[model samples]
Target: MGRSLVRHPGVRGCYTAGNKRFLQLNELDELRMDVYENVKLYKEWTKQWHDSKITRKEIIVGDKVLLFNSRFQLFPRNLRSRWSGPFEVVTVFPYGSFELKNNKGECLKVNGHRVKYFYEGQPIQARGELELEDLPSLWDE
Candidate 1:
């Protein structure tokens, strides 16, 4: 009689509950897989965007460049500049490396990423000079 009651159509069976639990577990697994794929795609997009923003430095042998000063100094001043050199590029190596010559004739090999091209000054524009006699004086009025 008990077996018959358990197997009755109106009564909730153990096998039915087990089947529902198994289905729920499968749904959770599918959702987890989807999240993993989305995270991977996001990482790939971030890497691509970062790579696009990077500018390639074209360094030549004779160009003047400033080297980054990365050395740790004690009691560093707040207004001090971090770049140390207006060094001349003596040689450019194959893979983003450079040989630099300082003003004291000291040669140092450093990575190209640490150096930037230095601009001395802008070209001076020529204009006609005006004398004080040709200028209008506000005091005369």
Candidate 2:
């Protein structure tokens, strides 16, 4: 003897219209539940995928970094430079806050996200001997 298929709860019969078959109300509900579960799984995967691509910047005190000038971005200009300073890092606080010192001896506290490591074409060299002429004075000439 052949086994009979059981109807879903509250579903009396299959729905059909114009050569297309439709799911019963309970079956449709099950499909919706499956879709919801899939959406949640995809959301988690997307978060992991996004985080995997992010490169965390390692910052420390005394490091030289360039601050991104967001103000310039507001007024879009062809020739305007958006980055300013190879500022010295004076302090580092929790959660990406950093204190920087500029050439004018002005100190500013800013978020780490706005700063990036300063890069020059060549590496800086430090010599043990101090040459007075080579050193820049604190006071402007």
The true-versus-predicted C-alpha distance at residue 35 of model 2, in Å, is: 1.2
Shift of residue 105 alpha carbon in model 2, Å: 0.9
Clashes of each: 0, 0
How high is the CA lDDT of each candidate model?
0.88, 0.84
Clash tally for model 1: 0
Candidate 1 stretches with Cα past 4 Å from truth are 1-8, 11-19, 122-141
* lDDT by residue for model 1 (1-141), tens: 122222447666644555667668879999999999999999999999999999999889899999998888899998989998799999999999999999999999998888999988888999999899998999999
Q: Which residue pairs in model 2 clash with each other?
A: none
Candidate whose lDDT is highest: 1
Candidate 1 versus the native: TM-score?
Answer: 0.71
lDDT of 1: 0.88
How does residue 66 of candidate 2 score in lDDT? Answer: 95
TM-scores of the models, in the given order?
0.71, 0.65
